[model samples]
Target: MKSLQLLSFLLLSYIIIPANTDGGKKKEALESQSQHTRTKKDQQNFATKFRLYTDATKEDCQIFYNQLETLDKCSFNASLPLVIIVHGWSVDGILEGWIWKMAAALKSQRKQINVIVADWLVSAHQHYPIAVQNTRYIGQEIADFLEWLEESIQFSRSNAHLIGYSLGAHVSGFAGSFISGTNKIGRITGLDAAGPLFEGMSPTDRLSPDDANFVDAIHTFTKQHMGLSVGIKQPVAHFDFYPNGGTFQPGCHIMHVYNHIAEYGITGIAQTVKCAHERSVHLFIDSLLHNDKQSTAYWCNDIHTFNKGMCLSCRKNRCNTLGYNIREERLPKSRRLFLKTRARMPFKVYHYQFKIHFINEIPGKRIEPTFTMSLTGTKEDAKNLPITLAESINGNKTYSFLITLDTDIGEVIMIKLKWEGTAVWENLWDTVQIIMPWTKGTRRPGLIVKTIKVKAGETQQKATFCSQSIDNLHLYPAQEKTFVRCEDRFQGQNRK
Candidate 1:
């Protein structure tokens, strides 16, 4: 009985521990190692892991592509749209979290998609630079497989979309370049393409717009670490979206670190460090799930201007969505688009640009005042969003503040405005105020409201909000009415 108990313990231990680090985490292998592992006795000679899943229902009917397949079980349905997903570096090239999630998201939207997962787990296990080198060889192998499919099964590369993350992005790009002509790849979405070894490399050596007809890239981590970053900062694609300034993503902080710790103990640190790096995947997922709530990113010179609200205008073709369903044809040439986002899931935000032109009663050095405002829609309300000057309020020019509301507030119905401080502190550099003496002797140092122009970025909705109360009230931090919304085009307010 004790011997049997020992045998049971061994069996349970083998079952509980993953065969490899990322192994068995997926429901079904893109190419099942149930038949053979890439690093096994026979596959020791192999350089790549290429597998096709044309139909999700047919889990047993996987079409594994070997360089030596004579069009036997390796045939694919040429009519369906093809999406090839490639992963970055890992010890075992087993499919990780995003791989399965993205596949599920894609399959959810479309009826038929030939989603092939490129698994190069064995070749991907080396040091960063070494694995970076191997991506080229792996890409070539992928290209060879595509060529084989095209020739034998009449597969069209025009219907192909390669979605690659980190180093896998480079692999996709290399593959795109390898297979030439009018029958080239349709699109490539690079999710935070690896920044270390392939960042500044030649376009031929890495993912580039030239590789595919339409290339959209999401760069979530690009902050320099010594001489390296986790994702490429360059606008390599025709449409490169740098969500949340494109460096340190919002939710990648101590809370996520704690969550990771709770999930996997000390080993969760691996994911914690890559929170920002891995955000691109989640952003893409959000785009798929919520098409109606799809957020638009603006084409801007810098994040500062974008945050300031100068870049919120959807003039001509200035903005684009940052996900899988991004308009394949609309956005032109190349743009490093910028946008603000929420820290958590369903990470869409409603963008608002407030343009306020201040009229001063006493004009001696216009003190830019601190202000807070609230918005009340039909269903819900947003409270106390700080309104700031986009730039130095020169004379009576309009100042813009680009702000975002995370929740759906229906149609904005009311807006409440409040002003603070005696002399409006303009800049951090200009004002170093510990305390301010009360407005000295009847100067009446306050602002006279002239025009308020507001635009909601999502709806292209325009409305002007003006205070009916004494046009220039004392800068007393609280307005009698806190919510201002329009009944028709421009008229609604709430008091007390």
Candidate 2:
């Protein structure tokens, strides 16, 4: 009940106050609109502006629509690639700090690129319903500017790349739809595209693969609340990436809300709701910063299969990079890729799939043992990682499970496995031993694990691990064993 009340309070606060502190003027603008109808002049009040940033001008230079002189003043270069960044709904009539940060990052990464920030805060500052309705008009306005650029300066649309966040993602789609055929935009990237009124709408209405020559989306927050999601739940691009299942992120927990509150006061409450939604932006920024440590996402039917270590294969376009370095592969159908990321920046992590087969010495005997693994590689060592099993280990049965390590351990050279037995089960086994006289002299229940198979996601490397000493292959409760890389075939071979 407290959670419900807190959520209600947060929602009410979000509607009452804007994202930033400049809510007084915005509230007046929103209140001035007619409750039943909006006049054409009122709609036109929400105009669009473009700000250009380049290597020559680290600071932004304002560019106006149908103003060729403004482009010359801003030193706009038609020869270089034009990258445009569009933002989503804003309760305040101001661009967020991330807009400037992203513009700076783009300029720093590519010296020859032209960065433009499409500012539509005037229309976006109104009530959400009005803001949603204005996306089409804002999109048309962007198209008109692009069309003018081409006619006045002989600019080619093929050199344009649109990166839009939230509602702006759909705005880019609307812009693309207006300018079609031989003059399509080079690419469009949707960062957690908005879901309020766009979910389940046709492709023509929302951000779709047809919006540009290539379209990709990163979904960070899609959990539903009152039958609506904050981010679009459906695939809105050619390659849709659901990092950490797209429902919840690693660090955006209830506790983090308090942390944000402490940092930004009441405005922090709004940041709490946006933490996961804004992760899409940071993930893209990470791609730009960490070129060598790019994250990899694999194609999977569902998150369930990927969790079981079943979909790590990268055969035939099964996997691709997560962000800026992603390969542009246009297929007849959209592809859904899944991956796990760290809580903070430099979010890349190493993924591995471990497959081990257990053989019981005693017939019909099964054991539910807990395991902890430590891996040693050429680069570093990861210690005491817990291994979770879905079910009990049966005789001669193979189990596959996923494991993630924060740092790259390089090529895995050795693994240490420890078996932890439950006290209740151990006591029960002692009673059984005393009752069965035949079992009194026999060896205690043990499992034989000769070899293990491993696969790496980023490098697509496969390895086989064999017991260090064949004589001590039996693994009993409260025992530990070591396995090292060896040449062995795990398939179709009988376990001894």
Candidate 3:
């Protein structure tokens, strides 16, 4: 009986011990796998990082989320206003050079201000669609960091200004959305906000006026290619500025690709491709560097009306400075402002509308003559500027065209108009007048431009130019006439 009991105990121990050991090994393997997953997730969450730039630091200081100690180490001053710059999608994992350039510019402008560059290259350096999706997660992380700052250091949300480019603009919007009520972000400046997925979405779905207390957007590359716009076309903020009609920029033509390559080597390919889109970033930097020469945009119903030079009025907040100097006024509805920019830096250009009434002395005749105009202003003279007319000038009709000058010629004082026509047309007109002596008075078949009405966009100044001598006003082929600023006759005259 003792041997039998001992045998049963031995057998049970062998079976139970092996089973328990196998179960323990399986549990260990599962726990290890779970731990690895948790670690990877934590790393992914922490990938979005902040780099602080201040006057005190020659190099950027890394800032960690939920790490209050990092703030002090980074020389972050809660008392000063904070400007956060968020970048967009990246093909390469490395951050672009513009990030540092913008940070330096911001620091240079206001030494006391804090500039934090939010970097999410780890995720942003992926497929465009994936990078776009990562924006939401990165934005949430930014909001969490801001909340940490507010709770830890009592930083005021109103002192925070977010400047985002491309997809990052929507990211900033997402961050702003996370904070509600009195803690909303003070301002968000979208530098050519990305379009693809957000273009026709609801205001709540993308960057809108409601995203921040004062939201402004600059659209530089809204022109569609392959049925997709690189920048958002719709007004996504309280103040939406469409520079150069928000299409093909002045210097971003295909010919510039070669010029870019000459200047920047192989990398110029990317630069040329993104020149128009990246222009928004440079424009913002220009505003910081040249505050005195800030670009101004006028509120207009559409670019067509703006191009007609009818929206140059500065009355009742119709005009606002673009970029850093933008007015923070919030209207009940979005205001689409339009402005023209130059090809290079100091992009501000002077817009002018020339309204010339042409009187064709010859009956039943229309003259299609080329015009060369020069304006003498208080400051300087813009000479040999060509005026392009879409159609022939008819009798008793006013033709209005828009022109832009890179230099501010100040108040207009004098104007010179020259008419150029083909030699055949000139000879034919002279022969008709001489042969048909019995027809009408001795007046020739020429254009009689009585007055040239001018409207200055930047200054919102209007002036009238009259020929120095009424007899010389008859503009014939190869003839030039001088006009000086005269009494305002345009007030009562019809203008289109």
Clashes per candidate (backbone, < 3 Å): 8, 0, 0
TM-score of 1: 0.79
The alpha-carbon lDDT assigned to residue 349 of candidate 2 equals: 89
Clashing pairs in 3: none
- lDDT of every model, 2 decimals: 0.70, 0.81, 0.80
RMSD of 2: 4.9
What are the candidates' C-alpha RMSDs? 10.7, 4.9, 16.1
Give the lowest summed-lDDT range of ten residues in model 1. Answer: 28-37
TM-score of 3: 0.87
Candidate 1 local Cα displacement, residue 352, angstroms: 1.0
Q: Report the number of the highest-lDDT candidate.
A: 2
Whole-model lDDT for model 1 versus the true structure?
A: 0.70
**Who is ahead in lDDT, 1 or 2?**
2
Specify the poorest-scoring 10-residue window by lDDT in model 3.
29-38
lDDT of 1 by residue, 1-496 (tens): 3442332233223322343354433222222213322222343344665566544553323455544452346455577888888899774445687787787787787857767778788878764555666676677667767776787678777788899999899889988887746567889999999876566767776798888878999999887644566788988899899999998788776456568879978656556656787899889988888877787898899898888777876787778888987877524467889988888778889888877656554444556566887787877988888777745444555577787888878777677777754333333212322233245554334454554667888878887665655344333323333324333232232110
lDDT digits (tens) for residues 1-496 of candidate 2: 3663365356544553442354444433223112223333443333888989765545788888667898999989988999999999895577888887788878777889989999888888876656766777777777767877888998888788899999899889888877735668889999999887788888877889988889999999887766577789899999999999898688877677778889989777778778888899999989988888899999999888888778898999999999888999887899999999999989998889998877865566566788999999999999989999767887777788889889999999999998876667667656655654344356555688878888999888999898998676878766789999888856558343
> For model 1, which pairs clash?
93-121, 413-485, 414-484, 414-485, 415-483, 415-484, 415-485, 416-482
Model 3, position 24, has a per-residue lDDT of 46
